[model samples]
Target: MDNLTHSLVGAVLGQAGLKRRTGLAMPALIIGANLPDIDAACFFWLEGAEHLGFRRGITHGPPALVLLPLVLAGLLWGWDRWQAKRGTRPKDRLPVHFGWLYALGFLGALSHPLLDWLNVYGIRFFEPFSSAWSYGDTLFIIDVWLWALLGLTLWASLRSEKKGGKWRRPAWIGIAVGLAYIGANWAISAGIKASSHSPYGLQADLIPSPPPLEFWKRDVIYRDPETGRWMMIDYSPGSAIPDAVPVAQGQPCAIPDLSALRKEDGELDAFLFWSRAPFATRAQGGGIVLHDARFYDPRARDRFSIALPDTPCEEPAGE
Candidate 1:
């Protein structure tokens, strides 16, 4: 999920019964939710695309969640206390219950990545150290129903929760609805894949996005099992795929030093990979396009193109 969304969730969590007990818990919880991302280091340290997959790495592995927090928290707490006793800065004194703080931080950071792993991308809860990857392959990155339910409930309860409203339970209910919605989203993605009959006979993987009011959209990647033509699907009513045709040369131009480009910005690589194909990039400079691959299409490239005036991709090259 996006940072804004995560922070919003954190805000809700802050106001919950927890606020009375732990006002600082909100940021800490949000941080804990995304803690699993610590594994992101693996992407840099390990070589090969496969390395990115779950491998029981330290960050994702179950043990780290429990053990790492304990070790780090204990070490930090001890260190902080020692420093405090040695220093005159009483304001910097450590919290007596740093353990709880550590636990909260760990939990908050862990949530984001766990949720991400639930998507088909999978996560190597135990990476580098272990090759076992955990994946539910269920749910889009974002869910409208989840946003509506949780966001709405949170908003509604914000002012009134002080007066009294069952807010915490809603999180559980929101999660339940999220799970059910995930199932439905999966069904919808499968249907879209069937309808497209992609070259690889893919099952569309849904992505959650805001704007244009498109409830659900899938960016599918896979070779047509039959044609082996390799395809990409920006499967959205508002997406480019709806009225698009294949490019002339490989989708992304053979940009000089693609590796260098990728190293410079991975999102560029993701986007280019998704745009890859037998098509020629007629318009030069940089642009975003979708492609079909096993993992994801229309990958997470952040490079911007010349802006258009009215429509998306409408700006003339960096407008």
Candidate 2:
């Protein structure tokens, strides 16, 4: 999830709890919610094989998400005790302090991966053991409907905190249920993928995407070694119905650097990542021209170029 959504999730969690200490709770909640992204920092260090799928790899993996929160909880407990012992006697009215705080934070962090799995790219929740990607393909990176509904209720709840707030509980219930339902939606999406035998749909490994839910647009893209085509499936929000698409036959490699990408370095690895994008093409001035094939209009060249050789791409542009 993005920062704004993350912060709002935290604020909403804090306020949803309806504790008077929600003000202090907000920071703890927000930090916990976005905690999983801590692994993103590793992007600067890793490259190639060691780096592949590392973004949502081990750190955001299921095992790590499960273990990290407990570790943090224990650490927070020890810190609280240490702080209390070192200073003047800690006040008794700490409200819901360590355990709940850690729980909230852990849940917050967990939410990132859980939500991320909803998109086309699945998270390796069980990393180290299993890299099998799992996704719901239900939500976009940012869901305005989710944001608006959850955010409005939360903001309203926070704003009206001074007086006896009414919508707060409803909001909490809505969010909790919605998150669970969001999870369910993905399960259903996977079921959809599992059911049909459409060659294109199978290759795309289709999943639902967010926004404009009614249209069931934003096809999911995946590589199909079997068909030697890029597969895509357009899925409606809740319905299992699908429309399949596959890469045109014998499409040029477009990316000349495929073989070289396997041997990754800094800039080389960066270029390798960008190369995966469907419409990405090498621009004359420099980089690749990326096309948004999902929204591509055959009439207008959908290809968008990006300058590369941030240092240099030894690989040719048009293979």
- Return the TM-score for each candidate structure: 0.53, 0.63
Which runs in model 1 stand beyond 4 Å of their true positions? 10-24, 38-58, 67-103, 119-122, 132-149, 164-173, 190-213, 233-319
> Residue 137, candidate 1: how far off, in angstroms?
5.5
Query: Per-residue lDDT of 7-26 in model 1, one digit per residue for the tens?
Result: 55555665554544432455
Model 2, span 61-115: residue lDDT tens: 7677777766666665665667767984347535446666566657777777776
lDDT against true structure, model 1 = 0.48
Give me the candidate number with maximum TM-score. Answer: 2
* RMSD over all Cα atoms, model 1: 9.6
Report the CA-based lDDT of candidate 2 relative to the real structure: 0.56
Instruction: List CA RMSD, all candidates.
Output: 9.6, 6.7
